[model samples]
Target: MSNKPTCRWWPLAMLGAILAVVVLTWFFDGLKPELRLDMRSLPPGAGHWLGTDTLGRDVWLSILAGSQRSILVSIGAALIGGSIGVGFGSVAAFFGNDRLRFTLRAYLAALLLLVVFVYSIAVLWPTVSSTGHVSVGISILLALIAFVAIFWLLLRRFNLLRSRITFPLDTITQRFIEVISVIPRLYLIVAFAMIIPINMFTLIVLFAVTSWDVMARMVRAEMLKVREMTYIESARIIGLSESKVFFRHALPNAIGPVATQVCFTISGLLIAEATLSFIGVGVSPETVSWGSIIHGYLENLQAWWLAVFPGICIYLTVISLHALGNDLDRMCHSKH
Candidate 1:
């Protein structure tokens, strides 16, 4: 018999365990108040497997409740940020004039660099809870500028189309894209306006602003390259309107890179969250993340299990995402 341990089953096994933890936590959270952890009556005995935390609350329950926070933050941040980044980048790719595109590239590069610097500084002196309002404000502002830059680029593209030729409903469709683009961008601005002082939500906002551009830039580059392909050129030569060539031929091909970027981006964001939490700049102490969990165990290094569990979670998340991106890249190439 092969010595190999059916490694393929590992991911499924881990996922199953994670799912079980979630379900069990949900069940326990809904338990009768009296049935919950009663520190006075409990010890490291048969009933309590993991033992109680400092506050006499069940460590297991705390972990479960905290997972809800962590997952929600990650999902919310990814959706908000990913949408802005993808939508903005697509507009820039499809419609921008050379000048607008160049300007946008320069600005985004600068902003990304600035964010990197900020992240480094934040990492050096981590806090239990960062300035959520400030982080949210900065993120929203960055998103707005990025979105506007992208919209301007798309507008220029539409103008180019208008100068060359038009399609059926080109005017209406162009106008609609232009208008809808502005709406999402505006939401970013409004998000800044309605800022609350919640660290978890603010961190999500931060992640959304900083992360999406990488995906957007990748998508934009793919679109630019695809637009110059033989099919696109032929379409243009045959007097096909710009929108038709962009939407029908170019955009679809560009989606592969975008999808791959998003997969990677999600993984990156999770790591970023952990990093932020580790340094004390991410979620509040009230919440639990791999980073915060590790932070709690930092001094208590002897308690290896405390750090081990969270570290594993972080590593697995990153690895899974990297694997997902690689698979998507292969699939995309195979299709092409």
Candidate 2:
């Protein structure tokens, strides 16, 4: 009833509507020829909302399907990489023996070296067929293995925190906080690795890797600050182990900023993916991302609608994500 205009609802409302349109288009992508792209496809009138593409495919359908893939891949990358980063980061913060820190750093560096080596191979040979599938699978496996190894190290460190029975619950809670920290850079790195693979899965990983760095750094910074809090000091004084105090007392509180990052990450990754695709480094030409769509009609400057509509779609989606992140941040801080 307060007349303060609930900005919170706006993003949800817009997202819902966009999602609905995407669903409709996906469901009818092949059914109705409402926006089919053939020359016989008539101009926008009562029937077609966005007109047609060069192949007479419904512009709306193409946009919907393409957006779906982009969103799914981004979210997937965020979740996967984010979780891995958080686990290892939290462990390092909690029971961080100099040995453990050195070990993890060494492990991460080794992974980076391997990825670089593989990337060199990809750049040099660059197959354009099902080989992309193998490349993408290898990249994903490498990313996952690296993440898991780091997380395992973190888990082992957390076990040190658990020795203090007075705060056993706290040590377990570290996992969530740690995961959020790794999301930004880890996702970004995954996305970058995916870029050269020329496969759908690789494209998703590329976006993931490029986007997760910010989240991981944000989480780590928050944990660092939280580790110095009064309760944390008290927990240590009361004989609560370092791991317990670090995971239980500090982690939950640090999750506040993670939501905001998620919103920005989504929008940013979309633009990044499109840009990559435009440069011919993202998904293959057969893929229907907004970037590919734009590339398809780059020479046909007169028929600008092909590129215009997809660009608009990207803009709208990004704006909606940004607005949502802002609203979520407000909601989170308001609670604090």
Candidate 3:
């Protein structure tokens, strides 16, 4: 009755386009690296809509393949990272005693520091060696195991020190978060890429590990507020187990902000992956990605289609995710 027109189909259309791209790439997997030396670097024409790359591979097909990989990395990282953050944060906020909280905080801090140190060593190890006999990738893997062993020993030392001193867990956690927040995230990711393997699975895991802190902080802040609500107190008064009250009541209410954070996080991760690929640190040389496509033809002035087409896809995907996140945030706030 009002003058407003419904555009409910728009979101569906966007989703359908994304799914179509993914599905088509899978269906046409044979075209992934098919070379056409006869048509190398040709501009857009009837035979090749988006033209061919320097290697004579179809630009359009490459974009489609890249999208599938990027989407998989983003979605995989978001789901696993979000779950880990939510679980750890909700439990920390609602269930732990002072000693338990201290131990958790200490462990998280140690793990973060250990990862940074090991990654640094792995990145620089190759340069330090006089002989080129050692493989950087193998060094990183061995360093990972060594670092874990070192962390175990350090954890034991910290546990002993923890018993001798008592500190506010909240204050310690806040300080640690602030310290991490001050460091540039992109540089940190690059550092990890330099040391860690640059395959899709490892990239997904790296993103998840780096990203969980933000999710944890958001969930913890939300849980802190939700825990004081009357419903939570009532659940406790009714003799519900602490885990039951926390998981069933506190977590559900606190999850709204976390969901919004997750949406934005996915977009950021996508961009991060692309940026790393652009700089040659994201995926392996053999793997195709939007960033890799752009990087591939960057030196050729005539291969404009290679850059422009994939660049547009990257822009559209990131914008779509941001719009979705904004809508979710509004819906969540409206409910509250």
Q: Top lDDT: which candidate number?
A: 3
Q: Candidate 1 has what TM-score?
A: 0.59
TM-score of each: 0.59, 0.66, 0.75
Total clashes, candidate 3? 0
Assess candidate 3 and give its lDDT: 0.74
Which lDDT tens digits does candidate 2 get at residues 1-336? 663324567678887887776566567646333333344333444555776656665666567777766666666666765665565455445443331223444444455666655654455234433354656766665785677577556756665333321222223334544554466643444444454444566666555544455665667667777777888789889997666776678778776788778778777767767766666664654566677667656645555667888898888888989998887777777776
lDDT for 163 (candidate 1): 33
Compose the digit string of candidate 3's lDDT tens values, residues 238-281.
99987788778988888887766876888898888888888888
Write out the backbone clash pairs for model 3. none
Model 1 has an lDDT value of 0.57
What is residue 301's positional error in candidate 1, in angstroms? 4.1
lDDT of 1 by residue, 110-151 (tens): 466666556533542133234435575566556756765675
- TM-score-superior candidate, 2 or 3: 3
Cα error, residue 326 of model 1, in Å, equals 1.8
